[model samples]
Target: MPRAFADITFTDSVKAAQSLYGSRDANRGFELAEDGRHEIGPREAQFISARDSFYQATVGDNGWPYVQHRGGPAGFLKVLDERTIGYADFRGNVQYLSVGNLMGDERVSLILMDYANRRRLKIWGRARIVHEADEPELVARLEDPSYRAPVERGIVITVEAWDWNCPKHITPRYTVPEVEVMLEQLHAEIADLKAQLANR
Candidate 1:
């Protein structure tokens, strides 16, 4: 049997929620529209698009939280509409724990943080899976360089609530020169290996 939160009375549920997550701020609830302060706006959408990766949280059959990193295009997340966002599910090795969890329960939370920019976006929603054969839009999104063949499905999230996370105190750095040198060395090694194989 599934662990049922539905069995708890409304008052008990409220108390439980507060105990678990701290006090209930009027700006933080299930419905984005209900919380005027937390609602996602145009600027929020742009910020999310700029993020490199997002963290996804799902509840497994045992009700334990399962979290993972989801990465792809610069703004792999697309705002399908005011209340919906679409994300492509990339190919991976056969452990489909997240997909299985989604099948049983759709509620999910996504967090995208740009440590360099000191910005973040938190999205709470319910997900619906769309098989590749059924969704042309998903197919197109998955066609980009970030993914390979054999996409199982795509997830469409109906946004319940979304908010901007407070900025953090971290600076960003890049190592362009080091990366270029490494690539050059790798190319030379590959050429040497090819010449040896040819002589053999």
Candidate 2:
């Protein structure tokens, strides 16, 4: 728990709700979330690097929260440094809703999930949209050429704080690769059994 998270999440309204539920002490010690804790350490960097896609949320001009899924090859999101992370913003539905929203307000929220592992990470950050013409090198840093998508811009996020969500209700899911691995093991076992029967 980073103090940045506690500062925003443990507000009077939230505290009142906690008190109503007689859970006032439920989130104790989160205030101790410090710079070292909030900083994106090696583990956090590793997790973010492995994510192929994430959900980004921004407040629209009309005050509604608009969430868009951003995706690319694995490790598309570049960990520029401890506090900064970015990704190439590929061409998408021409609405530009998220881009417009970020212009009005830089504050953004992101959710990255590893469904196979039942793990999720929540991030709060300020985002900026930079055009390729303006910062080609920065955009180049984030681009995954193999993805073969037209990158209209680069969305850079200055991480403010991050938190790992609990996995209590997450149902484990397996990807094609994971299933293949299991199938290979079963096939090998079946072959071994057949060999034993032949020997008998």
Candidate 3:
């Protein structure tokens, strides 16, 4: 199908979003000034990092934005310039939802939060997925000691606008050790259930 047709279909799908969300603020509940009053500088750009916890937003085929948690090495996120960030795409279980979204649309958003300090940074940009194996720039960024595998592709985000969120007093919910324990328990439960089914 032509790109225009896909865009038209996506547009039609989102027409009901406002009604479904029950509010006119359908886009992540963020409000942007029309007159471009807010501006981000170099000092502010340096504060956003992957280590602090980041969320990546990509548009589905239906034009709805899907957000996912992004985490890895701190250097996985490179501030190419004051208004650009780049990161490698590591191999996962092969469910490339974000990559699929990028293929159809390059626009994306990233939100990084420093929970301990109650700081949050939201970034909106265009993303380009580089799939070539021998791309020099991608290889250089993947050379960081923290990355265990060679990156198959990289998502380059060119920041268009940014917003800093205010502090909200919320208690910490989970810790690293708790996550591991929960996973172990779930694995054991699955194994037991499988064994019982085998005997049946």
Q: What lDDT does model 3 reach?
A: 0.67
Better of 2 and 3 by lDDT: 2
lDDT of 1 at 4: 19
For residues 51-170, what per-residue lDDT tens digits would candidate 3 score against the true structure?
A: 535889899889988888866766567776665678777787788889999999998877777664566776667898875565776656634575677577877776666666557763
Give the alpha carbon lDDT tens digit for every residue of 72-120 in model 1.
Answer: 7677777766777777787677698889899988989888876645666
Query: Could you tell me every candidate's TM-score relative to the true structure?
Result: 0.66, 0.92, 0.63
Candidate 2 deviant stretches above 4 angstroms: 34-36
Cα TM-score of candidate 2? 0.92
Best-fitting candidate, measured by TM-score? Answer: 2
How many residue pairs of model 1 clash at the backbone? 0
Q: What is the C-alpha RMSD of each candidate to the true structure, in Å?
A: 10.9, 1.8, 12.7
- Give per-residue CA lDDT, model 2, range 1-200, as digits (tens): 34677776688998899889988776766766455245688988999999888999999888999999988888998999988999998778899999999999999999999999999999888999998889989999989878888889999999888888999898888777779999999999999999999999
Could you arrange the candidates by TM-score from highest to lowest?
Answer: 2, 1, 3
Q: Candidate 1: TM-score?
A: 0.66
**Which pairs of residues clash in candidate 2, taking residues 3 or more apart in a chain or in different chains?**
none
